[model samples]
Target: MENKTRPEGFEQIFFADGNNLAKAHPVKQDIAKLKIALRQLHHNADLLIDAFIQRCESENVPVDCHMGCQWCCNQAVFASTHEMVVLVDYLERRFSPEVIAEVKEKARLKEEKLTELSPKEVLNTSLPCPLLRKGTCMVYPVRPMGCRIYLSSSEKSCHAKYDNPEDPTVIPKLFDFTLKAGRQLNEGFAASMRDEGLDMKEHRIEHILLKLLESPDKKNEWLQGATIHDNFPFDEV
Candidate 1:
């Protein structure tokens, strides 16, 4: 995907007002389009993943995912409503009510445990995901797309590579195409929210999670603007 063409929707929001758009760094309309196109390129990532796996097998690249080594799961992950809806549905169908209650309680407890840290610190902490069961992801089959493409090709430190002393995992290969796809998905969702006039500026993981828990139907609401708002259409999880 090139900058010459982008999703029509992308331009609508990224260039909403002349003044607001001008105040920021000057990005030509075409360059801005590239951002959207870059995102759309990952829309069919399932196909890409299958291809990636085939390539990996042929090239002898080892993927380091296994039982009890879920470094990614031990973090405060966030998702768009689409991702949460998928996970919530899977949980409802596969787990019992007790399990669901347990997950929610754990989520609340984890929030308190990490409350004092900055949002980035909270997000970066290596605590077990609220849905982890005995060190395993309860919703592994339906886990978010972000979890699927983070293939660690080595045991070396990714953090150390960047000179970060606290880094625990090394991502020798992150499948950038997948990340591009997610960016597009999020941008598109944010664009849709803008079209519907929603605000999501201050929303963090907690805000989104609370909204999901309060009303699954709330997902239908428009999540727009540079901020997150509590209006528009949604479905209950």
Candidate 2:
């Protein structure tokens, strides 16, 4: 397949991140080693995002997203299996068993509701993210690329879309260049994992997290380059 043209100044970032992640791939079946690689990936991505936001500010393209902005949190979130593993690890280490159980139940309910909807319906539906609690992401620092890249230029536009989900005309004014850069960074890392013969399929955050949290062994299987979950619906990019 022909490669898509990357945004200006992002091609080098993509190659550098991809090469670093590919080289960081653990030679053995060790989850700690894998987490280290994932942490590096997140750190690099965050730096790029921070630079992008700075550029946007200098160019007068303001980003209106702020703390307590939960409008965007009421939408579907898709993440890679690798991200889910890191999230699971974080939850287990930082949260209590009861909190984890609550998250699982929330994810379970959302998954159940989502299973009955078509892809288009799912997109138009506004369901609160399982990770969102009290108007903040429970795992903000380690949030997936999809969540990190979603920056709106106007809070009003975001509110319109959130309040009028069925109205196709009500669209959020998101920063296109930021989105492209973020997605390419993620794709570059995914490409590296693909080269290592690992499964890089993306799924709804709640769906995949529920599966991994319920069956902890699946996380190890995935780290060892095993394709385990095949029945879950693929999150539309």
Candidate 3:
């Protein structure tokens, strides 16, 4: 059985934006109901993460991961637009205006470094996440699923170089476990539980995060507890 932590103020990011949406016309009822699916997804994602940790332990992989380690946080990890919408809404509600302004400024700078064609390069450029403040992820509990899964591994995978045959190799085997298990479990979950009919590729994570930052509707509704829903039912993106 999944051991779900009782959600707190910081944990609110995991849930749907219901306060404002409750007022929407009845047409959005199905969308509101999507919270249930998202919750299930989170539960499944948690299981995958547990499996990753267990794999690392079984293999005796040395992981140097810890809190305040923001290296992975810099990269542009992929996530569904649905996830981003939920994340942005939660941040809006939880963060103060000053915090939001600071985050936007950080994102603005990060955005300047990002090229549309090279998302990974931009994300992996060693710059901490725009929302990272004083060595802590400001969005901690509500952070993306990728961010959560990545914590179970060591930092070596982030620095490994399969391209350099001459380089002496001592990197931990954590990435291998995450890659294999992620493919087997996480991918399966996304395929089976995702909302049906949505164009999965239409929203890349970087685009969604950037859009969420800029969208006042999303920002406000987030503060007021609202998120975008597809007019037509769409699969999880």
Q: Return the TM-score for candidate 2, rounded to 2 decimals.
A: 0.88
Model 2: weakest 10-residue lDDT segment is 1-10
Model 1 TM-score is: 0.59
Q: Order the numbered candidates by TM-score, best leading.
A: 2, 3, 1
Query: Could you give candidate 3's per-residue lDDT for residues 9-121 as a string of tens digits?
Result: 42232222221122221223243444444455556556766776677678986556776555556555556544566677677789887888887777766656654435334
Which candidate leads in lDDT?
2
Q: Cα deviation of 19 in candidate 2 (Å)?
A: 4.3
Any residue pairs clashing in model 2, and if so which? Answer: none
For 79-181, candidate 1 gives per-residue lDDT tens digits of 5444454456567778887887887777777767766666556544666677778878887765654566565554343333334323545333455654554
RMSD of 1: 10.9
For model 3 the local lDDT of residue 93 reads 84
Name the Cα RMSD for model 2. Answer: 3.0
Candidate 1 residue spans exceeding 4 A from truth? 1-43, 155-173, 189-207, 214-217, 220-237
lDDT against the true structure, each candidate:
0.49, 0.78, 0.49
Q: Is candidate 1 or candidate 3 better by TM-score?
A: 3
TM-score list, all predictions:
0.59, 0.88, 0.61
What is the alpha-carbon lDDT for the whole of candidate 3? 0.49
Off by over 4 Å in 3: 1-32, 116-120, 151-153, 156-173, 183-195, 202-206, 218-237
